[model samples]
Target: MDFEKLLVWQRAKALAVSLYKELANCGDVAFKSQITRSGLSVPSNIAEGMERFTNTEKRRFLSIAKASCGELRTQIMIGGEIGYIPALLADRWINETREISKMLSGLINRISD
Candidate 1:
């Protein structure tokens, strides 16, 4: 249950790091802040959830992380459509978020069982 050992957590962390680097040169402060915050939240929540003592607490945090995945995907899409993000890069981010969301679902279900 260690977050570091989780592939989803690792990807989420890498995504956040890449996002921060990508947004570093962005001229839109609002967009940059929103995406980066949500991106960071994914891994942060996963780690925090995995550290919880109860399944309920872990599920709650995982749910939040999943929600953040959705939020980040939306932001990435918008950024792409608006030309702030490259299409290929945005697509990659969206796909990664989707995978992370799925992973979180599996983890949540396993914890519930």
Candidate 2:
């Protein structure tokens, strides 16, 4: 199956694209870079995992992607509190990360089985 066809991958890619566009004008370079990297990691890892030859390899990459979701969520919360991100946008991204994490978990479980 193509990774791009997966809903989780599509949503994850969209989230990363949104972050990059939204933070394009951010003044804090470090914060912007960190958040965007983590956001990008989710879909990147998912695609990499799906391309792997073995289920174990796929699960490992999916797990890493799931962890990246948590990392991105934390950054979003801090960015929102620090005014780097708008309250509503932060909330939406946070929810998206949560959903992405859940989807990754489902993929990992399916791979395991």
Candidate 3:
């Protein structure tokens, strides 16, 4: 099965939507926008990468996706610091992000080998 078809990606997309909702109305508009931007980047990159016809293109996009996840992780931490998000919720998102990053990395490594 195509990695793109994985339910994790679907869940990630759903999760990102919820995340945006949570961040959008939060106080501090600038920080909210930044967090929302980084949060959306994960699935956006994945969808773009999955659409590519070439493996190299897919790999490159996955790399970008992974990087965005890292960015999201940092934004989330800062969100927590600023009281934008609760620790429990932040931990949950971070774990999911890390899992997705690992999955993408595994797939990319397999492609390279």
Q: Could you estimate the TM-score for every candidate? A: 0.97, 0.98, 0.88
Residues 2-72 of candidate 3 have per-residue lDDT tens digits of 54586646756876897887776687888878777877888888888778888898889879988988898
Per-residue lDDT of candidate 1, residues 1-113 (tens digit): 67899999999999999999988999999989999999999999999999999899999999999999999999999999999999999999999999999999999999973
- What's the C-alpha lDDT at position 95 in model 3? 86
The lDDT ranking, best first, is 2, 1, 3
lDDT of 3 at 73: 86
Off by over 4 Å in 2: none
How does model 1 score by TM-score? 0.97
What's the distance in Å from true for residue 34, model 3?
A: 1.1
Predicted model with the maximum lDDT:
2
The C-alpha stretches of model 3 lying farther than 4 A from their native spots are 1-4
In candidate 1, position 90 carries an lDDT of: 93
TM-score of 3: 0.88
